[model samples]
Structures are given as C-alpha cells and as structure tokens.
Target: MTKPVIVVPKGMEFIRDEIGYAPAVLANGTLYIAGQIGRDDSRQLVTDKEAQFVQVFENMKRVLAKAGGDFDNLVEMTSYHTDMRDLPLFMQVRDRYMKGVLVAWTAIGAAQLCGAPGYFLEVKAVARID
Candidate 1:
C-alpha cells in the first residue's frame, strides 16, 4: 500500500486546515475528488442557481487541475441536487464544461447539502490520470 497524495490547489489551504479534508486524493493513478459546492474562492456560497452550478464545476476543475487531470480524464461523477427540478439548467451548465466528454454519471436528489443553507449542489468525482 502507498500513501495517497493530497491534492490542494493554491490558496485552498482551508480544505485541510479548516474543513479538515483533502480536496482530492491521488492513489494508483486515480484521483478521488471530494464533493465540490458552489462556494467561490473566498468561500462565499453563490445564491443564484445557475451561477452556483457553474461555480461547482469550476471548483471541481481546480481540484482536477491540481491533481494533474481535467474533465476529459473523468471516469465517473455523482451529483447531488437539493431541487431535482433544476436538472435541466444544471445539465445545460454541465454540458458547457463537459463539451461531449462522457462519463458514468449519477444524479441524486439530496434533502440538503453543505455548510450553508443555499448550497444546493455538490459534485463528487473520480478521474484517471494514467
């Protein structure tokens, strides 16, 4: 067994220092990314639904980049939504980033999520760097 490399992007010290979890972990050429919420770099949760969705993906992208991967390297994704009805808009924003790159994705409806009340979406993912 080998120790996993913790992936923490620049200026994201809070992921380990405050939040007490690795943003992502790299082991055996695979990156396991934790749930990404709508918080901006300053940690303020985005209120607008559409913008929040985009922010979540941007957060995920940052983690992936820190792990030396990208959306195209994604192998699986699981998204939790507080309001399932927002699926249409969410997919629109997701597709803009996905850009035809397909992965095993599961969309789940969560009652509530994150530290803030308005953080409606959380996306967790796995990607292969090899």
Candidate 2:
C-alpha cells in the first residue's frame, strides 16, 4: 500500500508546524481534510459569522486544490458550530460555494472549539478523486 501524502497548501505554515496537523492527507484515491476554521493568513479569527463561513469553505477549497481535487470531488462533510441558530446562514454560505456539487453533510452544535474567542464554526471534509 502506498503511504499517505500530507497535503499542505501554500501559506499554511502555522497549521503544519505550530498546529501539528496536516490540513489534508491523500491516500488510496481519497483525501481527508482536517477541520477548518475562519482564520486568515495571519491566523487571526474573523469576526463576522458570514465571513467566517465563507473562509471555512475557502480553506477547504485550498486543501482540495492541493490534493488535485475540487468541490465536486467532495463526498462527505461534517461541521461543528458554536450555535445551531446559525444553520440558515451556514446553508446559505455553503450553497454559494457548493453550487451544483452534491455532498452528504452533518452539522453539530458545540459549546466551544480549540480556539474559541471569535471562532464559531469548523468544517471537515472527505473527497474521492478516483
């Protein structure tokens, strides 16, 4: 069996070294992306919920791109939100990026995340490339 390849998109140095986790790992035609939050290049959390939601998707897209896949390749996703009340907004942002891509998803409410302060949501995804 081939070894898993850790995918580290450009400009994700902190996530690779400081955070000690690969943004995604590719193996056996599948890519597993880690939970992505709304932090910008500087690693500062965005304050707006809508912005955060968009950033999460954008971050996932970056990982997918690094793995030679796209949104259409995504098969499943799981999201953790600090507030379930933001579901409608989350869905709206999701649709903006997902468009015609069909993916199974699950969302759960959580009291907090690893980095709380301004962070509200985290999204993890799985993609099949073959």
Candidate 3:
C-alpha cells in the first residue's frame, strides 16, 4: 500500500514566529487555507472594519488562486470577528466581493485577535478544485 501524497502549493509563507503553520495546503482536490486576517500581501493589518473586511476577502481569493481554486469553488467560509456589532460591516464587504457567488458561511464572535488595535477578523475557507 502507498500513502496518498498531499501537494501543497508554493508561495505560502512559513512564519515560525507566528502561528507555526503554512498559510495554505492542497490535497485530494481540496484546499485548506489558514485563517486570513485583514491584511495585505505584506502582512500589514488593515485597520478600518469595512476596508479590512474587503481586504480579508481579497487575501482569501489570492490564496485560493494560488491553490488552483476560486470563489466559485469555495464550499465553506468561517469568520471569527472580535466585535459582534461589526457583522453588518462584514456582510457589506462580503456582498461586494461575493458578487452572487453563494457559499456556506459561519460567523462567530471572539474576544480579540492576534493583531494590534484588535484586528477585526480572521477568515478560514475550504475550497474545491479541478
């Protein structure tokens, strides 16, 4: 018997000082992406809730693309938000990015995040690939 191999894509960062995990991985046509906060490519946190939400979705899309996936392939999206009141803001930004592409969504409230000024959110997504 042979072990099934997992083909994790490249360009995902390995930040040992941070959470000590790769940003994303691909195995058996499924891509598991790490939680993406409201940050840009440089990893700088986006402060504004509305802007940060958009940035977070954009970051997720980029990682999915690197894994040979897209928004249409996304099956689940999990959001952890520091402020429960920001749910509307999150949706407002999500609507702009989703463009009618529906997927399973779960939103949870948390006390705080890993970033300063309490970065609003961290998103984890599971996407299917061709």
Candidate 4:
C-alpha cells in the first residue's frame, strides 16, 4: 500500500502560527513557496524603504533556506511598495540580492501595509526545485 504524506519543515514558526500558511510544499518534485514579507527572524517589520527592501529579501532567503531553496532556484517574485518613489532604491537592493539572474518580477504600489509607520516594501517569491 502506498500512502502520501505531507511534509512541513521546522523553523517555520510563522507559517505554522502567525502567517497561518505553509512555507513550501513538496509534491511531484516541485516546491511552492508562499509569499514573504520584510519581517526579520523575530517577525518584526522593517519600515524604512531600503531597510525594508533588504529585510524583505533576507526574510525570503531564510524561509527559502528552511525549505532547501535559494535565490538561484527562484523563478518569480512579486513586490509591493507603499510608495513608488522608492522604486530606484528598491531596484538597487533587489539587483544586489538577485545577482543579475533577471528572474520574472512584478512591482506594485500600495497606500499602506499592515505594520508600523514607514513599511515601504513587501516581497513574495516562487522558486522551483527538482
């Protein structure tokens, strides 16, 4: 008899609790990662534009690493910003982390985010694993 099992890794406290979602699910040889915000390891939001952008990617990286994925494995990204004026700095920081892989990306602007003042950026990513 063959029974399918659901596998969720550890160190994903946010997904299991705060976020109430799985970080990644491996099925049929693919890993689907959920959207990630600019919150740090402590789940505290980084409000500054540049700071938030960096934290956004860092947060994503931590989750991805937990799921055995990495930036090179990423195929797509979606970014949300409270202000479009910060686009340049966002791009600058994004490129630094991306290493010029030029993966698919979508950047959008919003009036606000669910946190303290000055939370200018939010990012989510999708990565593939064989």
Candidate 5:
C-alpha cells in the first residue's frame, strides 16, 4: 500500500503546527486538499467578496501546486457559502482560475463556515496528480 504524503505549502505551516491538520494529503496519485478560507498572506480573513474569493482560490492553488497539480488537475470541488446570493461573484472569481478545466462542483449554502463568522466562503477539493 502506498503511504499518504502530506503536502503543506510554505506559509501554511501554521495549519499543521497550530491548527493540527494537513493542508492536503496525496495518496495513490490523488490529492485531497483541505478546505481553504479567504485568508490573506498574513492569515487574516479577507474583507470583501470578490477579493476574498480570489484569496481562497490562491490558497487552493498553493496546495495544488505543492501537490504537483494545477487547477486543471482538480477532479472535484465543494464550496460552502454563507450566502447563496454571492454565488455570482464567486463564480466569476472561480472561472478566472479554472478557466477551461471542467471539474465536478457543488455549491452549498451553509449557516456558517470554518466555525467562524465574517468568512463568506470555504473551498475544498480533490485533484488527480498524474
């Protein structure tokens, strides 16, 4: 059996160290990326909807890149939203990165995300690494 390889990109060490969870795990050529919030480089939750969406995708990209894949490699994605009305803006930001890549996606409206308020979205995904 192949063992899982933990993929934690630079600047995300706090998640593993302080938060005690891997950002992503790669096993059997499959990469499971943990849900990413709209946190900036300093780990501050983003304020606006559009910029927050961009940061979320950027955070996801870091994990994907660290796991040897890109947005095109994503096979599945799940997004939890605090407000369904923000879907339009979220889709716009998502399309900017996922541009020609077709991946199964599910957008769900939730009461809250990441056990925190002020965060509008959280994105989790699975990717095929070669």
Candidate 6:
C-alpha cells in the first residue's frame, strides 16, 4: 500500500503547526481534506458571510489542486454552519464555485465553530484523484 502524502498548497497559510494536522492527505487515489474555514491567505477571517463561503471553497480548491484534483474530483463533502438560515446564501456561492460539479453532501447546523465569533462555517471534503 502506498503511504499517505500530506498536501500543503503553496502560498496557503493554514496554522497546521499549531493545529497539529495536515490540511489534506492523499492516499490510494483519494484525497481527504480537513475542515476549511474562511480564513484568507494572510490568515485573517473574512467578515462577509457570502465572501466567507466563497473563501471556504477556494481554500478547499487549493488543497484539491495540490492533490492534482479539482471540483469534479470531489466525491463527498460535509459542512457545518453556525446558522441554518444562511443555507440559501451559501448554496448560491457554492453553485458558483462548484459549477455543476456534484458531490454527496451533508450540511449540519451548529451552535458555533471552534473559531467562533468570526468563523460562520466550515467544510471538509473527500475527492478521488487519478
């Protein structure tokens, strides 16, 4: 069996050292991504909700790209949202990024996230890579 490869995209600033986890791991043609939040390349949390949603997907995109995959490669996703009412807005931004790349998804409503007061949502994904 091939060993897992930790994927760390260039120019992406995730606090993996402090968090004690890799942002993504590739093994056996599958890429497992850690939960991504709205933090930008500078590590600052985006304030706008819609923009934050976009940032979340963009962050995942970077990890996927590092694994030689794209949105179409995504096979599964699980998202946690602080507010259920934001689903509609989140979907709008998601569709724009996904661009018809469908995947099995589960959305969960949470009272708060780990980095609360700033983070509104988090998304974790799995993708198949050739």
**Candidate 5 local lDDT, residue 40:** 84
Instruction: Record all residue pairs in model 4 with backbone atoms less than 3 Å apart, i.e. clashing.
Output: none
lDDT of 5: 0.94
How much is 50 displaced in model 4, in angstroms? 1.3
TM-score of 6: 0.94
Instruction: Give residue 101's lDDT in candidate 4 (0 to 100).
Output: 72
- Give me the candidate number with maximum TM-score: 5
> Best lDDT goes to which candidate?
5
Off by over 4 Å in 5: none
Give per-model TM-scores.
0.96, 0.96, 0.83, 0.79, 0.97, 0.94
Residues 32-93 of candidate 1: C-alpha lDDT, one tens digit per residue: 99998998988888999999999999999999888888899998999999999999998999
Q: Which ten-residue region of model 2 has the weakest summed lDDT?
A: 111-120
Instruction: Sort the predicted structures by lDDT, highest score first.
Output: 5, 1, 2, 6, 3, 4
* lDDT, candidate 6, 47-97, per-residue tens: 999999999999998899888989999999999999989999989988987
Report the alpha-carbon TM-score of model 2 versus the true structure.
Answer: 0.96
lDDT of 2 at 101: 85
Off by over 4 Å in 1: none
* Cα lDDT of model 3 by residue, 1-130, tens digit: 3332333334335442354766676777777777887776666777777888888888887787776677888888999998889888888888877778888899998888874665889899888887
Report the poorest 10 consecutive residues by lDDT, candidate 4: 1-10
Worst window of 10 by summed lDDT in candidate 3: 1-10
Our tally of clashes for model 2 stands at 0
Model 4 regions lying over 4 Å from their true place: 1-11
